[model samples]
Target chain A: MPSSATSNTNGHATSHTKALAKPTVNQTPNAWSFFAVPRPIKRIFDRFPLLTYPANRLPERVQRVKSADGHALFIWCAPEDASENRASFNPACLRWQAFLKSQNLQFHTVSSSNHASTNERLPFLVVNPSCSSPFKSNIVSAHELAKWAVDQKDSWPVELELHYEPYMSLLNNEIRRAWQYHMYLSPNFEAFTAPSYIHSQTNSSVVRITSSWELQKAAREDLMKSSPRIDVEGLYASADRAFFALDNLLKRKRRMVADVSAPSLLEATLFSYLFLLLELPLDRWLDNRLPEIARKYPELVELENTLKKQYGLQPPAIYDALTGTKDSTLNSRTRLEKHFGIR
Target chain B: MTSRLNLKIWPSGDGFPFPSLNVDCLAAIAYFQLLWRTTDNAVNWTIISDWDASQSPNGQFPVLSCSCEKEIAGILNIFQHVGSCDSINGHSDLNSWMNEDELADCTAWSSHVLTLGTQLLDLYLFITYENYYSTTRPAYTAFLPLYANYTIPPAHQKAAEKRTEHLGLATILGEIDDEPRMQPISLRTGGVDPSASASASFTEKIGFGNRKEILSKAQKRMRLESIVARFLEPLEELLGKKRYFLSNKSPSSLDALVLAYLSLILEVKVPDRWAAEIVENSKLTDWIKREAPHIYGNAPNKG
Candidate 1:
């Protein structure tokens, strides 16, 4: 609980007094505000739901529909997408969406761009927004979404998290670099990633081109942090090796979507990366070796195949693309995944 | 093959300090040493401890410049280059004999060490307040020129800051810094401050009265344990009863990677040695004692 000073009074009213008290040289309150910050300046106070933000209004609201549902998850969804049945095309949002589904939480994924999130990244959950007063913070960052999910549940997949951190390094380093390299830096960017992330959000040619350049530049700068230049071959080789290692580990899973009790958070992450690698048109580039490497593992493909239906994650077009009229059954079981492992 | 292979890295400090203070550079040297052991020194590689890292492709140290191939930077790239050259004579790449499963396990564990293991080492050597300032900072003076030493050590520390920002360890590191400074009222000064203590009860003046301080101290211990445990526990579980990580007969790339980080933590004498203490008591201690000397080669100058 907050101390009495904070608890006893309305936070906003008390906050103005605190802000006024901050400087030693007391002057007129209106004197020295920066010309740039844009009026009514938001402030965070030491009270429950500390952040105070300006509400999104007018023209922006027309394109982006705000769900009044307290459990609405704002994600890196397409700007027009509203259906709960469709999966989030973006991997970052889909990870959380998959996790929430596994936890049996009924959240409607909101169609949002990166700017919709509190931290200006996608996949932030709006927690009880209806009860929140105007301009009061109600959004939970993607970083804190897992904590929120865990807090709500009585039973958790504790055993699956046994050695998650080390396994996490596999996903964070090798697989992540490969994914970034393919999506942003490779020829696949123009064919697939640009359509999904960049073109879908904007229309002006200048915005599309510059945003594409800026996004790829950011990925390049991050890649260059660990090396002198992007070693494309090295990255693909690492991802291949990572896939094989994950395949070795994935042999333990009988099914997906928390698997009756396994809630590793690693599962959600693996699913997101594997789903995109297997399902998306990332192989548009000649060097797009990730999809092939991802397919070599049967367990990985199986995990994505089962988890999609378990979570209702097939986003219509992808569902059609995946189950293309080749409805052939295996020795006994009928396969939902028709495109993968066809080497 | 006749001409010497020049591998440049950051030089060792005097009097048995590491061959390189940096983990990647250290691992790079250990990698070559392993290659020489298995290949009967066919590669003719020389470890040149040069301060100038500007010449390399990556603009970083631990670069391999050979007469036959283009100079490559980074440990893995260098390993790749050497692996490419393995077919010459009877020289075979390390782990070339292993089946697909073993090779995959080796790569996975090595990746683990390079990622999470690097973070843990950074937390210990560079990120912590007391250890960097008191010990690791001054130790750099012996290896680097005066101006470069000041610039380079801090660059490592700053990079460590960026690397570890995601781990949520800053608060615990802050508490750990305040541990020594949180002396009792009587102990901090020659005795209790008379003016300050006058308002307090008898128990408050003598010290041990601050429940908040005691509580934070306990909390700090648990947080520190948990933070280090997240990195080390899986490693401990993996290393149990095996002579090497996932192997018994011969050391692979994973062994070299783990040993590179392990030797530094055990050897580098830092004032706040909590991390080192944990490693000393871990499952890998015997493995370290036996393998470190053989791989690093006791004489830093000999390589």
Candidate 2:
């Protein structure tokens, strides 16, 4: 999911002009000016407890950027075949849509054919800054769009949710091969519904650069700040909400552990098991860092509280309760099994 | 009133007999029965197979039925009257019940298998109808141009002469002689081998190389049986020790299709050496014996 906020560059024009005149401040960081200086993301790092680790400590493969309103934009893509069954909106696209819907974003669906026709004439607008759109515009040519996004970064705070459909159809052509390579550079562009056939292109399931407090800090320093902050809490809360839907749909009310259904018990069972496996560790990460993260970005605290109350997740307290030492009294013995509707 | 269904499958007298009533139609019958059961046994359905030898009804399939209708339209009308239910996708109330992802998964699986099977049928048609083969040994020369003419006239004649050494001409080819001047070659008449050729054995067993090769080759060709094991292994693991695979719940359409295909493959007997070895293998033989009987039953029509 890409972040909804982008930076409005129009603000601080006088300060930018003054900084432009000063050669010291204007000096390029190596050849790429963007690479040299730490953006507003630096302050975002200082906001979280464990996440405040130095910017260089993070993995280079994961790129974090901001939307126009200074919201973090995290994007990824999944390439798949042109089969008729999945022609309109495939499983990967549906999953992304479901995720977006869960986040309470106002979404729009446009055909790649329509986008290709009008993209050059129209400037892509970041509509519904409050994350109201359930969907982002799915641009056809991701590489060109990514390059265009980087070029237009100075002009507007708009983020590109680049669609990877064009490259998929060109698998036979050798000359236009490095579309995926170009895709890696666009920090905000995401590919969706990636086919199993395209797995060889990248060694990842689907690239998702989780926009954390660091990216927000980058926007705070380098981009224009806006009022009302644009539903930052909703972004995080939506993820848990989607999980809650799955819970209601799949799990028996009493078991707290989800078992597979007869038609697809194997797939469902594995999916449920994997979700729990990922959630336990994630809950811990959120719990330990909530206080400091709450202080810096108050929305994060509210998001954390929502997750804790709704999902029965408390990273730090649960960790203490499970440790079961003489010093601990949390009584977290309520088996995680009960949560999945298992006996 | 008990509605009687009179099914007439297409291609009239000589097409692959509507899988039912054919010597080996049990698997197809089981499939139809399961299809009915999956739909809550709603429709009193009859399948009519039209053989190729049957008369064409003025560039249309011949169909006759009651219910104040005529032709294919009449048959369908009769079906509707008997079943009183629209097809699966056409049912409105059923669509609401099917919106659940569990039902969606079954539909998806069925569609996936149907697509794959349909493509394979297309390939089979292409091969059987278009490909050339040896007239003497149809089994030995499928999809291969075994009867193709050689360039040189004398060489082609010489090659044709040696073709007879390949197999017993009468048994390998049809017993009927095409050339009126040539006498009929009778080896086996009425399942009894003649005294002269009785001492002689069939050296070529269709696809097998030689009589001596059956043992070593049977051991080597044991891998084909692994497919049956592979198919059943997933059912056991995913389905667990339960009757159905999805959850320990009632079987859905997905289970029915898979169970039918498994029985068909198990029951499909071919005299090819590889197929024989596959049937002879204890693991596959035992698995087939256990699973096939449970899914299907002793010849329903025969009783």
Candidate 3:
């Protein structure tokens, strides 16, 4: 988390004179001056040759939507996709989507890539292209959505208790690592994740393959930080333990739901992960154990089902269908031959 | 079936617990202490102060060479192996006594502490420039053999860097990620220490001389505030007014894990006391004052 603290540098006249006289501290020594270097030496080094480097001209890769619509949440998705019964395929995006629905914040989903958001991640909410309002900002990025949602809701009945962050850390580290491993590093990457996130972005085989490899590599590197390798048993077992803990919490207290019936961020968070795990198309998920792990906790499955019923946002992806393998009538060799126009 | 049990763990100093230097090993030690008490000393084990992890099952310790000729590594597996012994009557783990929920929470919190809490320790011990030079590095010498000492601490610090790189805390912690490893430390001593000495407020900014330095100082403080809140506040909440983390009556595996972290943060004599200063005021201080001596025995004289 970057701190928003801005430092006020008030310059003094005396200090300015001192700074001008001195060679300056905390900077590279100029060839002329020796101590912080002396001001005379600094003046001498000021004549040294300077080189200029090219300023970065690379265009922003993100989707730029100019609030042409009211309350559109930009997320990673395919085109012509309606978000009915379709939860976001991305857990980060899905969490907010569920939260928005649970909070009854009126918004339509826009299928935008991660590049569209200022944070370089997705699920940013854009408010009021149709109207100008001082009450709300133009864009609410992913992390800011919770506070943003609160403002959108005139009354938040319950305050987030202290236990929220710690327990959330449980999912953030344990379950997230497992999810990353499953989606990007697991055997399912070639079949399911690649086709869904990377292949769907472009028809170019080179772009798709390269992006897929980079994505998997990044995931592998991330996983390797806490684990020796993609330790399947260890990651899954940790996630299972986390699920079991969440299950117990759900049973003991309705932390996920703020009121007796009003769902909170907790439900949104747990539901997004559970939905991805349980509802992800199984055939495309080779050697996948996340769904199996999540299913052990009845509460998790119930949460997913309830959230799906309320939000009606199941991820609009059947990976097999997305990749045109929904016609299981043809075997792999025939499918390849058909793809290439071979008789 | 008469093979004696031997646990190879990271070595620590004489005054602190035997396996105190590493938090994971400390947790394992606490579990062993519990097993010893629960089973009435029926199960005995030896602690081999080993520096090498290459032979360990999971490439780390506490590797327990059990009587059944099985070499088990990782704290949880070690707990399972010992708890399953006939002496303990097949509890299977120290956490097995917990109800399903408590047991699950114990496991989850353990994972939480191991990753995030351990990163905090990494930041405190390995990342901070002065603390690493003046405190943590020398401590490594007391724990490892000479040649091993030279190679090990750097490797360990490098791992810590890789582990928490995503946090983007290097600059805040006074470490520059891309700079040559030693260059930053030497340069920081010259630049940061003078400001800190001039100001003489150890808890405050290292120095905010210029606009860039002022911004860096503000960022450092902000990052510090957030990290302490994110990691420690919940721990404080969970442990509010309790003797142990889960129960008022007895200590659980969770206590052992918490003990591992708290003892290091509070007891380790780091020059950079920013992290400890924040946690010191929290409920953790009271818990440590009450429970640490009971678990790990008295602290060694700093003198």
Candidate 4:
């Protein structure tokens, strides 16, 4: 029996241990060690494989599956249609899916909402054991997922890497501000993004409204990090400047190179932002700005189309449903088919 | 009928008995000690340094569990609870020094100290990586098992980061997510030594990858200094040459609160000396020393 002193009110033994034991600054405990079997325990299991009933039951080369619900890599991403072709409507989730696709990694995507994730953020990846290893099964979300990808040797080229930080900052800061303003701060947040994304997740209208409010507040706070207050026109102008620089870079690269089929990490980052920005059903004033900006630079549109074709991503059907031009139910079914690769 | 009152606080380091590394824990202790000194209530307090805050009423430390099965968490709430019970009687009414206007002044100052003062302390102790890893975190994790020493500090640090973020200071300091990888000598340096001449030359060597990082860090440092200055201005002005804040005769709960923070700030050896410098430059250190015997039995000669 486990020690009673180790039992926390939350019923999590780990927390109880955390409360009892003091942490030192010397060494951070290996996260993998938490899942590693002790030498003695491993010996006991090795001596009698039958006694290790679960271990004996696991299929060959699928060692990680039995440890935690049987999978090499389990991704909790936003709901996608049947063929799993169209990227997630959530920009963050779409970014992860695109990143994974770019890396040519095979993984299972579990359709989940933000609430399902450990950090209440979507596009979390759970890495399971492929074979016996000291590293435990790890669940990485947000930027940590990107870090994990880098650890796996899926990194940008040196030229792209040099520009990666500033570009990422640009995306996370300026481009993100514009995208968030369009999605949440703008009028379309309530009419489109909130209802389709946030409202569908929860039953309570209060939660939907409050969650939207909170998200918008967070976006505003993020914007305010650079400046004391929000400047709508200034934000759009800064966003336009960022787009122009990116457009010029892509245009120059396209013109200079004979065959530039390989997508840069910069392109992936830009596509993540633009894909969401272009596909979302925003109010006319907010919606027209991005397309107008994109129309000025054919390179951006070409890149978007290339990414869409590469990923087999379909046009988001939520737009037609929101506009009341098509039956939402039928649109959703077709989307599901397209996403899941159904007949 | 006398009710039993049990005060649970985070344990102090071996040498530092009454003065806990945590400002909140120290404040809670100071509040309780003030109650004991002025009131007829018999309080039995336990120093449970490894106490699980999640088990408390408010998911924080310094919980006051009364015989009535009422568990009050947070220093202010516990103080209010004790006051409302009429446990603090006779000379214990420190508020008697203030007239209506003075009382309002006292309360305003108290609120300011609680909010801005606490934020300043949070920045000094937790938000800054050096102070956190070196002093605050080690003190809390000192008595715990080896495994726990690794897990608990990060958890507490994460919470502190969140608290600072909510207060909007995290933006100026850069998000916790953006904190540099913990360097072995980081705690030793105490978060970019203000006096270090090396930082000037170091910026040149930052390379292309970390150019943005270096710039933001400098920006954060400047903003933090301004914020610290802002928090100090009111306190410095209010306590100018006064025997105690808002009262000439005796120390009030406001005094206790301020002293709790001041004493902790003065005592802890952190990288940012702004708070310590403020305490040294003002009469607050003298006041803390003067009130030390009443709070800690005997005033500690050294921090």
Per-residue lDDT tens digits for candidate 4, residues A1-343, read 4566455333554433443343322134532234344456556655765643344554543343435432233333334442355566666777777777776665555556666567677667767555325665467777686676677764653333223344454565557767777777776665456655665556676786788888788877665443334556555654665576567666656666656666666677788777766654434333457555655667677788788778776544455444443445455445544433434
TM-scores for every candidate against the unseen true structure: 0.71, 0.28, 0.75, 0.42
What residue runs in model 4 are displaced by over 4 Å at the alpha carbon?
A: A1-83, A128-134, A151-158, A255-259, A280-287, A323-343, B1-303
Please state the CAPRI-style docking class of candidate 2: incorrect
Model 1, residue B127: distance off in Å is 2.2
lDDT of 3 by residue, A167-247 (tens): 677788888988998888877776557756776667777887789888988888777666343556656666777788888
2 against 3, candidate with superior lDDT: 3
DockQ for each model: 0.29, 0.00, 0.27, 0.01
Q: Highest TM-score, which number?
A: 3
Return the DockQ of model 2. Answer: 0.00
Highest DockQ among the candidates is held by which one?
1
lDDT of 4: 0.60
DockQ of 4: 0.01
Select the stronger candidate by TM-score from 1 and 4: 1
Candidate 3 lDDT tens digits, B34-64 = 6566555545566777878877655666788
How many angstroms is residue B222 displaced in model 1 relative to the true structure, after the best TM-score fit? 3.3
Candidate 4, B117-182: lDDT as tens digits:
667777777776656665677676676567777876676666556546845665543344345544
Residue A84 of candidate 3: its Cα lDDT? 45
